[model samples]
Target chain A: MRLQDQLLFNLRSLSRQRFRTLMQLIAMAIGVFSVVLLTGLGEGGRQFVMAEFSVLGKDILIILPGRKETSGGMPPLTGGTRDITLQDAQALSRLRNVDGIAPLVVGKAEVNFSGRSKESLIIGANPEFFIMRHLRIQQGQGLLQIEIDQARPVCVIGPELKKELFAAQPALGKWLKMAGSRCRIVGILANSGTGLGFDMNNALIIPVASSMQLFDTQGLFRVMIDVHSLAGMNKLSKEVERVMQERHEGELDVTVITPASLLSAFDDILAVLTVAISAIGGISLFVAGVLIMNMTLISVSQRTAEIGLLKALGASSRQVRILFVSEALILCLAGAVLGILSAEVLLWLARQQFSDLLFIAPWWASALALIVALTCGLVFAWLPARRAANLPPVEALR
Target chain B: MIQVNQVNKTFQLGDQPVHALNNIQLKISPGEYLSIMGPSGSGKSTLLNMLGLLDIPDDGEYWLQGCDGLALDTVPMDEEVRARYRRDHIGFVFQSYHLIPRLTAAENIELPLVLAGIPPDERKERLQPIIQRLGLEQRAGHLPNQLSGGQRQRVAIGRATIMRPKLLLADEPTGNLDSHSGAEVIELLEELNNDGITLIIVTHDMDLGDRAKRKIRMVDGEIVLDKSREQEPS
Candidate 1:
């Protein structure tokens, strides 16, 4: 028979049983909707984390004071291990492909400026910290390299710290007491938003030499490095490690974290998460497939005489099977369209509520959902379709 | 033309086999009007089914038109080839008027042409004359349930002949109708027969069976009587 006629016949048959058709549509739509929504959420989370990491500079690397374990979590510090010194940072800065380096010494101390005393975070680094962190001096001049090497008491304050200590007044050349030591405010940093889990606007920036004296610490906390290009990061990391190992007396006492490595680790974890959730949603589609089988069996039994009539009218077994299978494909494809539309509507609503979340279901996810739905419908429709096809026309007519 | 030789069909009723057709030998020519009359469970319907290619004989040689080689093997013929033969050469009318309930009378009549893969415009053209000849033009748009028993049977007849098959089989075609509707259906069958289509009817009504040019009586899976009013075959 002409495929158009067969399609029309199957459509009419389904229309006659409106309630059953509607129920099957709902089952399939629910299956497709769950997959779209959950995968959209997973993809959104992955994008959000990747965006945050991208903001930290793709070529930057952080070196911590311990080795990272394969089991993840925080790497334990080796006992009696000496702290990473400023000399180690200087040694790595001289390597090939190394653009710049910033030795970090972070602490919290009381700030007493103009009699407005508040406890704030202290970030201690050299003049190279500005370039490494992409920070611009918003007011006055930055600390000179000569001042950093001489351990002069000159400092740069963040925008928020400036507002708290100076209260809209010009703060350059003002004397500020950091912890127990007094320093001159040489520069004010521009208002950079919160990043890497800290508010850059609420911290104080100073020379490492001055911070070590004020905080009474001789050891550096962390080192940040910038590579000239992505191609040089791996070689530079190894070079840095080698230099650090030599400085630490043949002991590897530092953990090097390149953005590529960190992002890939996160990518692997989230990819698995995406698949796991999609599979969980796919279970519903499987259940919907079972429902299709049961419904098709019922339809076959009910339409026994009709099947006989078609066979008697010269329909072959293969044609009969194609008829039933086409019915399933039509139903599932209709449901897939409805489900995808509804999912798009849901994503729009989600976008309205959470502006930062990209609520898009990737094209492949949608395609996978559609392919899986169609496959499920066809596979599950097989047995009943074969049963209808193989029915003896004479016996069925009787 | 149709031919059957030493045809045998067996059915397993529970564990015991019942022979539905016993070594039956029959030959029918094109345009012949024949009827087989039998009591219940006497193999009348089984013979019709065999002729219609709806069933295969367990041991037989059967052929229709020029397709005799297919009957030589013990195994049944390929279903596709049989289906093609049926589409090209056979038509069937049932007692209960098996019109697809969802389709209108016109669509039901269009079924055979549709199955033969005739395009829509040609199918419409083919159906026009049959609709007028069956006097179903006014009732063409009605669904099966909306039509009376006589009208439904007419629609079934229209559907069966839409493809213009060479042979038409009607099994108890008037069984579900009142006497008046039954007579109309029988007359329709005879009219088609007179127009050069071979007609075969299976019935229990003696009067209906007697009206055919050739009459066959079957009892207990065997033919007891075969009589023809005219000696010459059409």
Candidate 2:
């Protein structure tokens, strides 16, 4: 018989049992839907974090104080560890592939303005800190003093802190008490959204020299460096570590985290998360496969006489098997298509709800869901199809 | 056209072994019209099914020709070979008028040609004359349930002869019909026999059996009597 006729006949037969076919299709669609939606969620999360990393500049590297290496025990009490200092930052800025660098020091201090006092975080940095962090001054001039002796006792107040302290009053050029020292507010920072670790809208920014004097600290907190290119990020990170080891008396204590290393570590973790959820969804496809098997077995038993008639009309066992197998393929394929379309719709809808996070299922997730669904349907339909094909015509007719 | 030597078949019913065919010997020539008449459980239908290739005898040296111009060994033939021959050479009519329920009478009539892999135009062309002869034109689009017993049987006969097979086996062709439709169906079979196709009918009616030029009476899994209108050969 022609392939067209075979398909037509099987379709006619399957349509007779409408309820069973619909139920099986739904089960299959749900299986595929879960895989797509969950993977999309995971993939979306990965993109969101990568975007967050881009806030520090794609080629930027962070230098923290102290070595990250773990040893068997603590060091001797008499020994003192070296801290990353401003002089080291000034030296690293002169190296090759170094575009710019900002030495940072942060501390908690009490701010008393017009008899109302509140504790706030104080960020200590110079002119380059404003450029690298992308912070803008909306009201007055930003930090401009670059030398320790020339740096005056001036501060930039975040917008939220400006509201609480100065509320409907001018904040720029106003004197506020900070950590037992009085400093004049020089700039009102722009209203930017949250950053990596802390909210900048509620903090204060000052010159690194003044913050060092106020906190009485000799060690710098961390240094942020911007490179010229992607390749420069790698070269500068290695060069900075080598430079730091030498400056610290051949002791590699500072840890330099490049964009490549951080992003890749996060990528590995998120990819595993995507696969784990997809497998959980795959269990539903397995259940759908079992439903297919049960329905096919019932169909075979119900159509025994019709199968016998076909056999007597000269259909071979192989043809009969093909008919049943193709029926399963059609069912699964339709459900898979439905699942993919629904997943895309759901992802689109989710993107509308949370524009901050990227919501997109990877290409492989859809392909894997489709291939797995079809395979499940095929395997589940095998035993019943074989049973139908192997049925003896004489007995079946009787 | 066909020869069977000492064919035997047994069915195990519970703990008892029932012999459906006990060392049966039969030979049928081309263009012959024959009938086998017996009570129930006498193996008349079983014999007809064996001739139609629907049942296989346990121990039989059976030879059938006129398909693909090659003689076929019935005993050792596999399912594929048996199916090919069944499609190419044999036409079987059951008492129940086993037309596929979903197919119209026209589809049922052309089913044999479809199985034979004939193109749609050729299948339709070949079926036109048979439908005219069976007088099923008015009922061509009707399903089996919509047609009367006589019309359904005619549609089945049209399907059987659409491939122009040499052998036609009818196991109780008129068993489920009234006398009027039964006679009509028997006359249709006679017309095919007159057209030089070998026709064999298995029935319980003695009058239908008498209409054949050759008559066979089967009892207890064996042929009790065989009679021909004119004495010819063994």
Per-residue accuracy of model 2 over A1-398 as CA lDDT, tens digit each: 88777777667666767888898889889989988888898899888877776667677788998777778778646655687877898899899887778889899999999898778889988878888879888899888756733447888889999999988998888999987787889898899756666578988988887888888887889888878778767778889999999998898888999767878898888788888888888887788788888888888888888777778878788877887889998999988889989999999999999989899999998999999989988888878888888887887777
**CAPRI-style grade of the A/B interface in model 1:** medium
Q: What is the alpha-carbon lDDT of model 2 when measured against the actual structure?
A: 0.85
What TM-scores do the predictions have?
Answer: 0.86, 0.85
Across B1-234, the per-residue lDDT of candidate 1 in tens digits comes to 778889999899999988889999998888899999988989999999999988889887887783342333322678777777777678999999888998999999998788777899999888899999999989999999999999999999998888888889999998999999899889889999999999999999989998999999999889998889786465
The root-mean-square deviation over C-alpha atoms between each candidate and the true structure, in angstroms, is: 4.1, 4.0
lDDT against the true structure, per candidate, is 0.86, 0.85
DockQ top scorer: 1
Candidate 1: stretches off by over 4 Å: A69-80, A94-97, A107-122, A137-191, A201-217, A228-232, B66-76, B229-234
Which residue runs of candidate 2 sit more than 4 Å off their true CA positions? Answer: A66-97, A105-122, A136-139, A148-153, A157-185, A188-203, A209-221, A227-253, B14-16, B39-41, B67-70, B132-135, B145-153, B174-184, B204-213, B229-234
Question: Which candidate wins on TM-score?
Answer: 1
